[model samples]
Target: MIPWVQLDSAKTPDGGQELRLKQRGAEFSIMLGTNELMNSRLSGSEEALAKLSCERIVGRSQPKILIGGLGMGFTLRAALAELGADAGITVAELVPAVVAWARGPMAALFDGCLDDPRVSVREADVGHIIRSDKAAWDAVLFDVDNGPEGIVYKGNDALYSAAGLGAARAALKPGGVLAVWSQGPDSGFARRLKQAGFVVDEVKTRANGKRGARHVIWIATLA
Candidate 1:
């Protein structure tokens, strides 16, 4: 077996905690110590989130999509596979290093998604983007944090809060969808979605293939 090599590293804004990127043969992974934050090739959470989020409103021509994170580009790729050419997608990635990792050592995992004409990558906070716009997107898919409850960053709390859901609602077109990915079920988040004037649907999917880590995808529709 080949050895894992450190490809790159960066310090986050808030805590100055280090984010490390590593490559083992053809596979790439992000880590914060022994914990594997993300693996591009495996892409369990990303694939599930994309599929559940895009399942319902896929065929709308010129549909606009807002993806909250750019982990491994799996979500973007899966979304592209499901959406049409006329559709456009904007991916808001908070950490520039993650974007660099995608374009650098882990580039191949993305399979040319960065250059896709319909796709744009933004280096900024997704919460800010969601709060800024009004009725701008046909679909907003959020895979940031580990659900309504976050792990890496505390600021992520707002993305799952009532005000954040409200912002997400304001950013969507009437009948537009806001899909959020979670590591586990959050009945409280579901309730918040309902209270925020959205018709919510909770869908659970496996992290790998049709079976693996149990993941939740919350599909919320603007009412």
Candidate 2:
């Protein structure tokens, strides 16, 4: 049996928690305390977050996408695969080390997706990006945190708040979709999405192919 090796660690923006990256043989995982935020081998829901959102914006000319988190490049790679050359994606990763891990130890897992012409990576808060522009994205996918209320970072709660959802609405073009990945269902978040003028659809998915963790993806559309 192979033992897990800690490759590196980074402190959360609030400095209240730490994110640790570990590798076991060919597999990799990002952890917050005892909770594993993401694992290279379990990316089904993350890929679905991209695939589902891309499907909603098909055939749009020069579609723009904003991905909140760049965990192992799962969502970004999946979006790149589903979207056409006319589509562009901007990924905002809060922790700089997460981006570094994607280009460093987990580089092979990303498979050069970061270098794709349609993709742009930034080390910044997705929340801030949402508030920075108006009607800027065709699809905004959040592959960040545990859920609306994240355990890794205390500030993530604001991203799911009423005002935050409103900011997301203002940032999205009409009929654009906002796809969010969660470990499980949070009925309260769904209610908030509805209250924010979005037509929300909650979909269930697995962390891995037909197995692993049972996850949830909320595809909210701004009508």
Candidate 3:
């Protein structure tokens, strides 16, 4: 039995909470208080976030997208695997330490995906990126918090609000996708996506491959 070791910690942008990076043998986890934000071993739903989104814009040439969180790089690696060489992905990770964890202790888990030519990592708020652009991305994926309710960073809740959803809608190209990962279901979130003028599909996925905790991913298509 291996014990978990705390490698490093970082504060949320609002400074109300702290994120801890822990490692147990070969496995890694990012924790917010007692809640585990992400685990290297449980990436099924996160991978699905990118896979489902990239799957939607199959034929679009030189597709470009924005990913809200860089978690354990599951979404980024999944997107890189699904997208062609021409595709582009910008990942906005709010906490610099998380990015450092990706390139540092969890580098093996990331597997050099950060160095991929099509990928770019930014230490900024994804919402700002969403607001600054208009019809710029073919897909916009979010895995920032536990759900639309927010856990790691409370300010991220705005990214799921009516106005925030509208900004996301405006950031996408016509028929583009907005894929969001959540720990559980949120009926109000689905409604907000619909109210934002998106054709939505609520998908239930597992934390692991075919087992583990059930997670949700909202595949909202801007049409």
Candidate 4:
């Protein structure tokens, strides 16, 4: 068995926690304390986040997508696979080091998706981008933090709060979709999505291509 090697570390924007990147041979993981935020070997749910959302807006001409996190670029790659050449995707990743890792040790895992002509990477909070735009995106996909209940950063709570959901709503075009990935189900979060004027559908998916632990994905669409 190959022992995990700590390749690098970065301080969260809030300075509340340190994110460590560990690699065991070809497998990679991004961890916060004892919690593993993401693993390269397990990307089924993350890929689904993009596939499911793109399914909803595939009919649109040149659809614009905003991805909250760029972990390993699984979601971005999946989105690129599902959408047409006219589609554009903007990814907002709060931690600059995560982006650096994708270009550094994890570059092979990304497979040059970051260099795609249709993709743009932003080193900023996804929440701020949501609030900054109004009805600008056709789909907003969030794979940030753990879920509505965040563990990596204290400030991430707002992205799942009522105000945050409202901002997300305002940032999407009519009939757009907001897809979220979670480790587990949160009925309260689903209800909050409804209260914020979205039709929510909860889907269950595995972390590792139908083998690992079941994860939750909320597909919320604006009527």
Candidate 5:
């Protein structure tokens, strides 16, 4: 059995805790304390959400997208592949170390997508950015935390709240979509999106390439 090796660590904005990145051979994991929040090669749910969301939002004119996390850049790269040359992307990553990992060790996984002319990386909280902006994005795809039912951090609870959904609705352009990735189904959150005045669609996809654990992606449209 291979032992986990520490790759890097960063202090969260609150400064009360730290986010750590670890590697066991080719596998990578993100941790806060004993909680294994996410893993690069293991979390297929996030990747599926990114791909499906981009497919729905991408158009002939090219589009602008905001991705909430840069984990392994699977979503980012998948989006760039789907969107092609004309589209532009803004990636907001809360943890600086994750960004560093994207450029440093995990660069190949992203294929230098971060340096792509069409992509811009913002080092900030996604929730803050969503609240401050207005009608600027075509699609806001969030894979941050662990969906509405958070496991990595408690502060993430707000992202799935009614107020958060309201702010997200405000940030989107007309007909823009808010695509969220969740490990499991949350019927209550779907209702909240509807309560926030969005036309919502719940998509279920397999986490394994073949077919296995089901993951959910909530696509809410500001129609």
Candidate 6:
């Protein structure tokens, strides 16, 4: 069996936690304390987050999309694959090291998606991006933290709160989608999405293709 090797570490923006990159043979993982935030080998749900959201806005010409987290670049790559040449994707990654890892040890996993002409990477909080724009994005996808509970950084909990949902609603264009990925389901969060004036759809997806643990994806659309 191959042992996991630590490649690098970076402090969260809040400076309360550290994110470590570990590699075991060909597989890679980003860890926050003992919790594994993302793994290169298990990206099915992440990919689904982008695919399902983009499906909702595929008819729009040159759709503008905003991705909240860049975990392993799975969501970004999936979105790039689903959208046309004219579509634009803005990926807001809070931790600068995660972006650096994509260019470093995980470069092959990212597969040059960062260099795609249609994509722009921002080193800032996704919430700030959401609050700054008004009806700007056709789809807003979030794969931040361990769902809405915020395992890595406590500040991420705001992204799931009522105020956060309201900001997200304001950021989306009419009929736009807000897609979220979670390790498991939260009925309370689902209700919150509805309270925010979105038509919510809770989807169950597998973590690794057709196998492994089931994950949840919330597809919230504004009328």
The residue pairs found clashing in candidate 2 are none
lDDT of each: 0.83, 0.92, 0.93, 0.94, 0.81, 0.93
Query: Between candidates 1 and 6, which one is better according to TM-score?
Result: 6
Per-prediction TM-score: 0.94, 0.98, 0.99, 0.98, 0.90, 0.98
Q: Encode model 5's per-residue lDDT on 1-223: one tens digit a residue.
A: 9999998888765677788888888888878899777776665677777777777676637678999888778778778777878888899988777898888877766777888999999988888998999887888998887678655546667878999888888888888889998878888999999999999989887766657678789988877
Which residues of candidate 6, in runs, are more than 4 Å off?
A: none
Q: Tell me the spans in candidate 3 whose CA falls farther than 4 Å from its real position.
A: none
Writing each residue's lDDT as its tens digit, candidate 6 over 106-133 gives 9998888999999999999999999999
Model 2 earns a TM-score of: 0.98
Tell me the lDDT of model 4 at 120: 98
Question: Which tens-of-lDDT digit does each residue in 63-102 have in candidate 4?
Answer: 9999999988999999999999999999999999999999
Instruction: Estimate candidate 2's alpha-carbon lDDT, on a 0 to 1 scale.
Output: 0.92
Question: In terms of TM-score, how similar is model 1 to the real structure?
Answer: 0.94
**How far in Å is the alpha carbon of 53 misplaced in model 4?**
0.3
Off by over 4 Å in 5: none
Error of 4 at 9 (Å): 0.4
Summing lDDT over every window of 10 consecutive residues in candidate 5, give the lowest-scoring window: 147-156
